[model samples]
Target chain A: IPVLALGIGSPTWAVEAAHERGSLIVSLVGAPAHAESAIRAGADLLVAQGTDAGGHTGPIGTFSLVPQVVDVAAGRPVLAAGGVATGRHLAAALALGAEGVWMGTAFLASVDARPSGSVLDKLLAAGPGDTVVSRSDSGKTLRMLRSAWSDEWEAPEAPTPLSMPYQDILIGDLLGQILRHEVAPLVHEAAGQGVAHLTAQEPVAEIMGRLVREADQVLADLGTTRSASPASIRPAT
Target chain B: IPVLALGIGSPTWAVEAAHERGSLIVSLVGAPAHAESAIRAGADLLVAQGTDAGGHTGPIGTFSLVPQVVDVAAGRPVLAAGGVATGRHLAAALALGAEGVWMGTAFLASVDARPSGSVLDKLLAAGPGDTVVSRSDSGKTLRMLRSAWSDEWEAPEAPTPLSMPYQDILIGDLLGQILRHEVAPLVHEAAGQGVAHLTAQEPVAEIMGRLVREADQVLADLGTTRSASPASIRPAT
Candidate 1:
């Protein structure tokens, strides 16, 4: 199995441990600099997760981050993540030079994911504009569906979210309470901007089939279409 | 001239005025709701400007925003904006259903743009990570090269930036003085995340030619490449 390491800090110990077991080390990154550090830590593959991702993301957007990480990945395969929910997004990721895509939010609503009732409801109703990135949940910046919980934290009288473990510890009890009690207005979940596209909870197999089929058609059309010509797109520049 | 209406608010008056003069109306939107409103107001064309843009951008990223806006723009042509500086970006925009792209930051460093000395220096040196969106400049969120001005405004002691027009008038004198004095540390310019690709100040013609050539090659290769197959990209799901 390939051990996936979080891309935020040095993962020397995890890399060494994975190597000891003869397993490949996959690392996540949000920037070119992070890609460099992951490579230095002996990561075999890279996942460039942009700010459009659901939880604990960096500032770079997927469109710009993929190419930059690919340029510095030293031939390692780079997977694009964040705001990726459709075949068009897959095609765009390939166009941006990513070897593949690492989707999170798309699968979150899948039946296999088994999301909580409140989380599933919010995910189905949310659009791209309905989500916000805030430190209110995890102390670290997290992109999540907006709810009364977020609003309360964003209030002028609210205290600043503490860093990392402290914030997690402080809110641990309240988070459990809200979830167990099913506090309708306070219930929320991490989601990407692509939440706009996930309107149903389907099986993983169907979602995969649809995505692959759509991407194949899009790629095929793009190759032969006159609209892809430089002449037709000249107005862009 | 086609009147371009800001999509943040209702543009009924601008639409009526443009119609009166027999001019087509173009509108800039950052979300699907804005696209609907712009279309309702009779926009002839739509430009989706995402959070990755330089000045006064909304929260949506270009990748997610383009397709969403396209879905609601009726039959009007939709142009993608923000984080669009290269041919690859142009291809991605098309994949996302945009008719073309409306780029801003790429040209900021071009010889034809004639950016001021301080602005040019900062633009050429800035990478994607070097920019931060802040309300310090125009009292509206603007992505710009991080500078002493932004740092000062972000400090705990600093007062909150007022809304537009009023904030513009308030800081008008200081902004003039800073520019006139050429304060090296405080000098900054509005730029997008794509600034990483603009390392030199070249002619606009060269930039345009390169972008077209690169995009043409990418699209052409994509048509026949084995890498575009669904089997090759199955890991994406």
Candidate 2:
């Protein structure tokens, strides 16, 4: 599967070239405008990413972004991303009109992924609110495990983080030293709000199995109430 | 329904008083911690409000907040709030373990709502991104239609908005004058990201009918794909 990072200005020529080779291009989008641009660039699949997503993300929440992207996708398939860690989340994404999910943080602590000890520990210890979106590490807004380093960067006296590659260059050495030396206070990893559900390190197969089992159970339970209609919707005044 | 604004200082005695009256107590919470507090305060039903909600809201998004609240609520019913305007949203809310939805933004433009002409116009003209959460209005973070007033408050030289009733007192006269004069650039209304769907003023009955019809269709469409097991869940690389 050919994929493109449309957020950082992937050339349309690259998308066209990939299309010419009969590759199905997948593009990640944080908003509907991005989805439109991806479609214009010949992307076959669109991932509607939300602020809850780890790494680089957008302002819109997944619940709000998915339906909007689906609307803009026209006939193209749209996948939901950000905060997608459970079977219930997958079911919710489907209900929001996505064909599937694009998960990232769920696998960060998986056995096969082999994340470093410090990173894995942080990922496991984080609650839903333990992550914050900051431009300190990357020039672009990124959701990651909060740490003392992030707090320092967020202080009033801290210099504004530069944009894009420039910011990466400015912090490259300090980040390397922190990681190489395993500075616990400064060490952090990119993760999503879904990290709240990740309490244990399991294999990919176990994770996949649990997601399917839980989602099936949820879907079946909701199916029994499928006849719920407008009359049944109680207004919460 | 004995609803409580637990965000503010709703005394425990009031909750006890309402409970004594044999009324079901409902409280809104934005995060799991808030839900725990509400539960402790004797709330019987919980509305898991997300940042996408209109007016005062919490930092968490509905997609991430609902299931967590459900887990905390245990057997207690949870209603999803924020960005809940469409039928698909209702279906998605149910899938996220919410028994129903608590809608606010969707009704702002309804004929029965009778919002001021200017406020209704702004709501109609706004897009999903047009609403922002700011502390400038009520001294609490509120989601409202973005306007010049909000822009002014967000200026670097602007003073921090005072908390709660103090903020209300400081801006009360100015807000009244703006509304009384129908100041086009200053007049705004609380709304959610779902304002993108409120294109025109319709009756509550019409809105309800459409919600039921669309939700039924979506639920039915998803029911066919309910058998989609883990194997069918394709990885979007």
Candidate 3:
């Protein structure tokens, strides 16, 4: 079985446990403060997450966090994640020294993903700035589209969300009800800032392929050649 | 002197003023929503800005915003800005369809810039996540490094800042005091998220030349086979 590194809590014990079981460990947690601990605990790789990521995220952005983690890892491979949905983004991540890229928002927009039609529609209509990072949704700072539910939590009068498991348990039923009923206006959707970039729904394979192709094109453009073709290369008149 | 087509408030007004003055009008404000308005107002070019940018910015990131702006500009030159301080970033901006790139944060780090040494030092020390968008400094959401002042404003008891000139007037003295005494701890300094990537301060001309060279190399690698190498492109890869 593939080992999934959960980043929500301390992975030190988990890393030790995974090592004991001889399983590969992946950590999805945020916060650069944890990098030393994660490395000391024997995390093979690191996933640098941004606030624009769909799930739990540390406040630091990919632009700031990736290089720092790269410096800290001392030559270990780091995967860039959070709000990465396009080929251009993938190219940018590689340029930032990421060995590979992980994208949740891109997969969320895939047809096979569990999101409903309306949710997908809303995601497609959104832009990078349309999402907000708030803890009210899942007891951690998760990126979700700006909605009434998110706005309520942002309001001064709203109660602070409970800690994990308890908070998820408390609102799980309500969240399910909202998702099942197609009540987008009432439900708060956890998504990334990349949601706004999604103009349409495509299959996961197509999306991934497009991303790879685009990234290759970008990389090729940046490689040893100066211009793509004669038509693209204009001379000084 | 080059006549700057300064966008005052409305794109329509900006265009009319530029036409009347026989100057090249530039849109200074942000927001992708303004693209159509600028086009309707006869904009000759577009500047795609990202949220990571210093000063004023739109909600769209440079990656997502530039392509759309380029498409809408319909062959007009598009200049990219916001959080661009390195050769890699400039290359990425050009790859995304921008004809040229504009940089501000880099200039802020220059010796000619008027920022106090302490402010510059603080900026040099900050990481990308150190900066945040807060309306407390300016009525509009501007990006700045998180400092005691910004943290205080974020506190529950902080007062809502007055609009524009009023706030400027009210806080002008405080700002001056902070700067005069090098009380940087009391004020949030304006900068971009790219500051985290900068390791040293160098001459602007050298930095600019390096960026152009790097961009040329990147463009070459992108499958472009043009030979218009700038003086900065050193043969050794």
Candidate 4:
């Protein structure tokens, strides 16, 4: 419960500081170098994040990044993040040598998500192609459902988005206002391409239970029995 | 033996032609729409190609794309492509509801790859970050090991590369000359982000064997047994 999961983009100081305190630290990585660095920096677990992730994601895909990170981890636990939504994804992550999965987009439309109603509505109606990765929102590569405003920012002649805090600061107030007003076309909420498939929002427990149920069904369908401890995930199913 | 798996970015003619001959058409798709379209166009199987794949790829990641494609396919076999380098990756794909996997970058290091010495050397020494995806090579988004030529073309202010056939035609002669002359900085060989995990080059049989062997181990480790026909993959083991 005291564990901390930090995005790889976050400063290394946070990872190191968490490790020094004897609390388990999970570092999300995009490339193999980061995975190795996280392990060396004393991360308890590494999450290989693909570009499909909603928040600040890297150029590499989860399918590609996870195995690379796992190999470099040298047996350290590595979880696959980004594009993680269903139980089958958990099975895939484990097959790819991930200890688990880390996801954010699945919860974006949840009952508790603070995004405005219009933003949630747009997310539910969008397809995979509806999402785009751009720095216009946060100065870093963040994936979100495409809006008229987001599309303009990616136009060939559009101004290059400012980097980091500058861009975030510049757009922060405007973005907040857009969300507050429930302007869907002008709203940009962090989401992955998987946002295309997830249409409904339900209780967190239901989502978690469904993921476990689907994963168990997938495992059974594949004729693969559970090899790891079921105590952790069984109760949910 | 009657199955043909064509990379999807190519026009539909090849796929249509193959399907007409009563062969199983497995067209690679990078997006969910492509998956649905392929199935409608008579493709027997769909390979969801992610951006991490070598050669031409799309924006979505395999973890995100595969499940989406699977959902659309309903019951059609959906294979995962791009970033598929090892058995664990294969297992992950299957877990994600892929019937199988499609791979090519893993073989780039093989003796049969036929790239120039400089390209091979670069590939061997490269990491995930060492490569890039750009249309500079053939005017389409192809992932390859980054070289001086590719980097310059990708610069923010660089002129956009031409589209398809024309771009390919323009670069064809230049690429041939660069490779023939053993130019190091000008080299650009199609590779995936998983290129970092595969370093050595051997025979096709060795690579294939390792892939199957590793896959079986992963399956077994997961407390699962092979549910599908193992004859073909088992032989490699």
Which candidate number has the best DockQ? 2
Sorted on DockQ, best first, the list reads 2, 1, 4, 3
- Real contacts recovered, all predictions: 0.46, 0.48, 0.18, 0.56
User: By lDDT, is 3 or 4 better?
Assistant: 4
* lDDT per residue as tens, model 4, B7-37: 7443567666776676677678888777767
After TM-score superposition, the amount by which residue B101's alpha carbon in candidate 3 deviates from its true location, in angstroms, is 2.7
Q: What is candidate 4's lDDT per residue for A1-237, written digit by digit as tens?
A: 467777744456776676566567777888887877776666777788888888788888888888888889887777788889899998888888877788788888888775567877887898888888888888988887888878899887899999988998998899888878877678778888778767787777888999988887876765543233322111000
Model 3: how far is B142 from its true place, Å?
1.3
Docking class of predicted structure 2: acceptable
Give the distance in Å from residue A156's predicted Cα in candidate 2 to where it truly belongs. 1.7
- Give the higher-DockQ candidate: 1 or 3: 1
Residues B1-237, candidate 2: write the lDDT tens digits.
434445543356877887677666778888888888888877778899888889998667788889999999987888999999889999889889888899888999999999889998998988768988889889999988999988999987889899988999999999999999999999988888889889999999999899978887877877778655533322222
Per-model lDDT: 0.83, 0.84, 0.67, 0.79
Model 3 TM-score (2 dp): 0.84
| Candidate 3: segments with Cα more than 4 A from true spot | A29-36, A63-65, A163-166, A223-237, B1-10, B28-30, B198-201, B209-237
Candidate with the larger lDDT of 2 and 4: 2
The clash numbers for all candidates, in the given order, read 0, 0, 22, 2
Provide DockQ values for all models, in the order shown: 0.42, 0.46, 0.21, 0.32
Deviation in angstroms for B110 in model 4? 0.8
